[model samples]
Target: MSDDVSLMLRASRGDRKAFRSLVERHQQSVYNFFLRTTGHPEDAEDLTQQLFINLYRSAGRYKPTASFRTFMYRIASNLAVSFARSRHRRDGVSLDQMLDEGREPPRHRLHDDPAAGAEWSELEEAYLAALAELPADWRTAVELRVGRQLSYKEIAQVMGKSVSAVESILFRARERLAEKLEPFKE
Candidate 1:
């Protein structure tokens, strides 16, 4: 059994420390998944908290049928889709708004060159904007494959799609992203 499954089993048996360990182990990846999906740090933080809470509540129901990471991402995917829809109705916010306000942590300056840092920042911003413009399914597919480093089959399980469908989504998503980013190549 995987470490996550072991931790989850312990959590199911009311082991608070095991639960906490699981939370610590997976929180950053879950947060990053939401951050990239939602393009808002606050939303990502809230969603991450919600995901763990839901995981804890559902621990007793968890079976080791799938890898725990895949299972958690499936939950995250559903939550993110619901959150996006509700936020869309409530705020009518566009991806542009999210991108404009989304601030990434600064990378270490290369040779202490401010100009290089600024350029990289600008490119990063543009890349994010392009990502946000993708269809939600495509974005999710790409993020799972690239950011989360899931195998295609794993991504398929998370998205509840066939592997071929995931492949097609990723192919189209990559083509679109490349089109958007082509101008940035130096």
Candidate 2:
């Protein structure tokens, strides 16, 4: 059950060890995807756990037609969309409000930063904000393409779209990001 196909087969049949191995192999990538999509560490953690639970529940129906990663990501992406839509039904919760509420280290706190550190932090914040502002599809495409470094084909697979569609999303997303950062560069 070391190989993805075999592991999936076992997990599909209620093999806990196989499921654990699958989780170990892909949990970080799934978590990171959630973090980037939600822009909220706490939400990411919760979503990630839910993703695993969903995976386990769906394992019995798992098919080996594509790479396990692609299958897993498809589920994650769907769940993310559902979660966002659910949140939207309520009063719009800002990304900041949805993020983890954990306290930060004093040194990493913005007010404590030295000039260079402060500048870096500001740039990072701006970048993240820009990403958060993107349309959901574009943002998901960018995250999968750049953050996860998935190829256009892989992205298309995960998105259940064509390669051209994924490329178009990335192209539009990049243009929007550039526009957002233009003022900051000056």
Compute each candidate's TM-score over C-alphas: 0.81, 0.80
lDDT of 2 by residue, 1-186 (tens): 239778888888999998899789888888888877877767788999999999889887877776787878888888877777677422243333433343221222222226654555444655666677677778788888887888899989988899999988899888988876664565
lDDT of 2: 0.74
For every candidate structure, what is the RMSD over all alpha carbons to the true structure, in angstroms?
5.7, 6.5
Query: Candidates' lDDT values, in order?
Result: 0.80, 0.74
On the 0 to 100 scale, the lDDT of residue 57 in model 2 is 93
Question: The CA-based lDDT of model 1 is what?
Answer: 0.80
Candidate 2: deviation at residue 99, Å?
A: 22
Query: Could you say which candidate leads in lDDT?
Result: 1
lDDT for residue 13 in candidate 2, whole number 0-100? 90
| Clashes within 3 Å, all models in order | 0, 0
